[model samples]
Target chain A: MERKYWEEEIETMPRRQLEKLQVERLRKTVEIAMGSKFYAPIFRERGITPESINSVEDIKRFPFTTKNDLRSTYPFGIASVPLQKVIRLHSSSGTTGNPTVILHTRRDIDEWADAMARSMYATGLRDTDIIQNTSGYGMFTGGLGIQYAAERLGAMTVPAAAGNSLRQFKFIQDFGTTALHCIPSYATRLAAVFKEQGVDPRDTTVRIMIIGAEPHSEAQRQRIEELWGCKAYNNFGMSEMCGPGVAIECQEQNGMHIWEDNYIVEILDPVTLEPVPEGELGELVLTTLNREAMPLFRYRTRDLTRILPGECPCGRTHRRLQRFQGRSDDMMIVKGVNIFPIQIEKILMQFPELASDFLITLETVGDNDEMTVQVELAKATDDFQLLDNLRREIARRLKDEILLTPKVQLVGKGVIPQSDGKAVRVKDLRQNH
Target chain B: MKTIKQLSIFLENRQGSLKRILSALSDQNIEIQAASVADTNDYGILRLITSNQTKAAALLSDIGVLVNVNEVLAISIEDNVAAFSATISSLTDNGVVINYLYTFSKDGRLVLIVRPADMEKAELVASAQGFQLIQGWE
Candidate 1:
């Protein structure tokens, strides 16, 4: 068989041997965590030591870290190493509020690049491929993360950093781009532009699509794959976990094989804070075992996903993660029923007539809370009967997905607004409306 | 039988969108001889038989409106009863399916713009019925 992994020894090592390495790394990581001022209190209170982590399971003793903690600490509060030693820093764009920052030393950068490279290899990218990167560069980790990995893999890199759809299409056609990396939302928007220009995405030179940085439903992913006529891999990561190299789908495309050797993955009950058994869904908690300058212990990523039960055919021993469902924080409870914006997005994708541009608004009038889904029709179809039929069908389908019938509002093309980076899917007016 | 070309501009159903398009056209000094809004709850298709086809299309497209030029038969008839119904009856008799029909009083006559299922059959029916099909709108 042809070589499959970037690091065969590490990627295909025996589970027992991998566990030994993980234990050793866990001990060192605890020491590294103790270096941080934020973790020092928890260490003293919990009586954590380098030897405190006797086995991998002992990591359960560590307390969880949160984005709010990172926010509270702000700049350099989580940094274990001195200020001068840190060479690079990446900050979350703070979709909710203020940005949470992460620092990386020279060694930390190499480790990050290695994780990204291994993931790129797992997704079947090669040095011979031409890569077009559309993620925003600077401050955000999406752009630089993939660019460095592609470059390290020796692929011809086109740093087409987001937006300017016309120019992006020009570059893709002109350069014969073989691989693309961007958020699923941006990729979906580009498909519309391709249709407008009479360009067939499937017939194009792009063979692989790397989608990450935002939560998307499986239906949305399938729509993008169908449009481009290429296989798309789901990438799972956050700014706290070195920005999108944490887990990625291998060629099997069943589940993402998270790099278990570098991090300890746990699915825990969000309320009880206890680990759920294999194949069950829960909040993803990650502990960075190999990162320097900053090390996280059980950082609550807020993303919801489950662990796949069986071993993958790809021969990688790392545990695989299911496609991220949605952010727990983004879920909206409507009239005693819980609904996710991605669930609404999946239902919207079922209708080809509706453009991908959409917004879900949650408002309360009187005593009841209503979720209003506003979307745009792909074409300016003025047939009143046809449009009325479409509206009714959308409401019916959405009601089927979420038990509560939504107030469906249809807009014209481009009326719901377009998302270039991470899509803003919800607007909550429960307090005011 | 001479058929004038019609321009269809896609407009969102929101308020002020049609006004914005009209202001853009008005700023360019374009004259509309006949116009109608084929609307739905979500969007509207504003059909126009302007004084100029190429100029109107270019003007709307420049203002970022999706504009498509189509061939539609415009009948210049007297403003009397059955003037519009007679033309509709002629097309129906000859198996010419009219997709949609809109009328506006222009040039001291009732101007009916007919979107037909088939152009050739509609023209044949109009010619056989002695209907005066204007080549282009005033």
Candidate 2:
């Protein structure tokens, strides 16, 4: 159930030893990237020699890869390895536009699974637990990535790829799923379904619920625990970054312990491209230290978070990162106040009378940005005044929580539309206004 | 007994816009007593009896939903008031503009529906000027 490499290097390595390993991996990755067709041009354009990059500190010399760079390269643009060696490819949700394609080799796949196994063990998941992976499978890395790790960890995995709430409930009851790997929002949705069906989620045998793919608040984490009657853990990783198990919340649940041996994480100011002080919020820049097929150097993740250095309470030497605040692109500025949709969502979920299905719309009325929270009512009632009460409660809550007043709307059940892939929780219609 | 105010809101026919209107009211703590929707191809009429009618109209107006207060009476009687002249005469004699009207009863109470030209003035007159307004079951 233990990964030998991770155990030997990550858990035991001292600060000096880990840095030495990172420098060695960084040097090798640079040499490999320089010889490849994709990264050779980037290196040549920057007028940097592969031999010049000897240590991890030399990573700053290379230009950071952004999502735009990935798109411009298009298809197999930034891939350092040959197409023949690439066994699998995972793409982003392309929510912003085109999906960023990520290629993986057999070795790379094994490393990913190993890293996930370490993450699972770090979070207290055992082989005896039946892991139900509710993340989407097909093109998304969530389902396949977690599925491999669960299997690798000797845990029985139910590859229940998202949706079908009823069947998922039946599987959890019938199969006795002790661990759940899915988004926190879906976990809450399932809890709601159980309530509507007159079933108690607390009475079930689910022990741990692993949530990822979306940013969630502490309030949300507590709510998920209250709903499922299980400890909810958060993992932070993107499809491009090797999916959910890149960093996992240990038993302490304070912060996600980053696998420093595989990935060198740096908190950098998004505008200045300079390193921020520890515990300060900045964009997460990651350098894949050991990625053979595609080793990214200082890849701009655009994920806002702070890095917490030191040994974890779980006895791991790797640095942990604070929970992702929100994506830089998703941060909405209304009336000179910065607002995150997750913040509003956390507030809404606090009310038992409210459903999880809600939408936040930002419209620019004149020069000011106006926000409208469209929440779906669970049932049909003749009480229109109850709707008014809910609206005022939301407005009051938003004013207290976000320091902004937004118009609240209560719609009929199933009135708000649903999305296929990752749910489109917020719609920015400011440009139209 | 405190009098409750009923509002007839005119909503445009669009995709999922009604929900937005209702969410606004629900957030404001205006409890709806009884409600019904009359829909056409162009627009829909949302009829609502709320515990706090003044607050509901103001909240709806702030959110850009056209709503107006109507002074209706809930009297304990059998059958609907077939004579419209009596209802109109009661308000018309007091310099009230009869904009539109509807009537329904609940729990053996006869409800008389009346909409004045100016909802604010109508509500003020109904409350302060001794116009009999409907109250839900005690």
Candidate 3:
């Protein structure tokens, strides 16, 4: 059967017209961005203005905005609109430091809903399909952000939030939920739970699985599809822009198509901060073209992936991003929880018996991604009780910091392969995401 | 109250890894007194008592292997069913938690290797039970 789009004309818009629209929106975004208390002074000092960006290429002239910039502008410092105009705010887990906050007005939320509606539609989710959003709701954008989009698409949405696997299964079977949105790792875990109950995933009415908010491999996507006997589509988005509707894979199952009208996508060498060659893997940089509350300019996403250099079979002119290869930074996504290497290092530094010569290993044991931290016992450390107790305490500290449990193993002094040069800290041996 | 030094070597679960570790020590003419491998899906801990643990660990480290030396309680008891039963009862009665226990035949002697949660309690129980306790065996 031929595929249908929710917004066919925009999805397959001509390249010339798409670029013109991007330039127009880019200029508008710059003007709105200047209203931000965070950017207004920068614009004045740097001699940057809306008139300065005559075309999309001129966007590069305006200095790049990094995650550090957002961190420094914590709270609503970066908001262009007044506090009264902002309707909602979502923040990332900031246990180690200040969390990145995203502010949105009513119009921004509606626009995000439209983008998410298209995201769901491209993956074969229609208004007739019942959607169960399993992403975390509160501070996380994945939960409520997509809920609005599904409702905007006229789909009966169940804001089931996260966890409660038994109730999740009941809602799926009882409501005949057709669209499933969640992290691939949790989906894998839930699939195993259902298997234990002797439930055949094919018997369920789930037809379209939108897996995103965490990077996963194509093999993982296929595994999820085989388990549920349904199509698993990949989506790409971050809280800095909107939510999970920035891009999504069509039924073609090629790469994720990022909407050009809402955001300008760029792949740049993280070190040099220059654009990479076509189809070359580099750090993904994005600019929010239509964000009224907080219009971001050249915000570095740190996600490393190449652009699939071709048109999609589903006929969406928007360029597609290849499967996430790895991150430019040392951000580790453990079971859908984002973790930084420094966080682990910082925790390890506090323990004296541990010499901090440790390696973080990511491996897939069955359907679950397990993080194992192999640390070295200090040379003079001979107290077995202290070592065992310290291991448990370190695990508790890590769980408190990252909100995920990790296997803490005490290895030999030289077991982790340290050297005079810069040592590799992470070893990812998992099949995919 | 003497203690036995047991070598705990970390081995990634793969074919011939155990054989490689065993052969590596044997190649050096180092004899493994008593050996056992506790395995998981990814890795294994090969625990062995050797007369030359310091040399064995040094040799393994030289060959880029990971090994640790831990002091454990090794007891020599009569090669009988009641001997093993009494051995456990002695420790459990004294509130000693047995982390793990394995036995092997060496020189016609039935030796029970025990790693306890409480080292002090284990040593005390073994002393009072009249079982000949060897610090660590070759």
Task: Find the candidate with the highest DockQ and give its number.
Answer: 1
Q: Per-residue lDDT of A32-129 in model 3, one digit per residue for the tens?
A: 87788988888898888777766778777777898898888898889998989999988898886899899999999999999999999888787789
lDDT of 1 by residue, A106-225 (tens): 888888888998999999999899999998898888889888888888899999998999999999999999999988888888988988999988878999999988777778889889
lDDT of 1 at A427: 86
Deviation (Å) of B69 in candidate 3: 40
Candidate 1 regions exceeding 4 Å error are A95-97, A330-433, B1-138
lDDT of each: 0.83, 0.76, 0.83
**TM-score of each candidate's B chain against the true B chain:** 0.92, 0.55, 0.93
- Per-model TM-score, in order, reads 0.61, 0.60, 0.61
**Candidate 2 Cα outliers beyond 4 Å, as residue runs:** A1-8, A47-50, A330-433, B1-138
Query: What are the per-residue Cα lDDT tens digits for candidate 3 across B1-138?
Result: 578888877666557767877888889898877888776554567888876898998988787566778888888888888978887887898888988878888778788888888888778777877768876645
Q: Deviation in angstroms for A45 in model 1?
A: 1.6
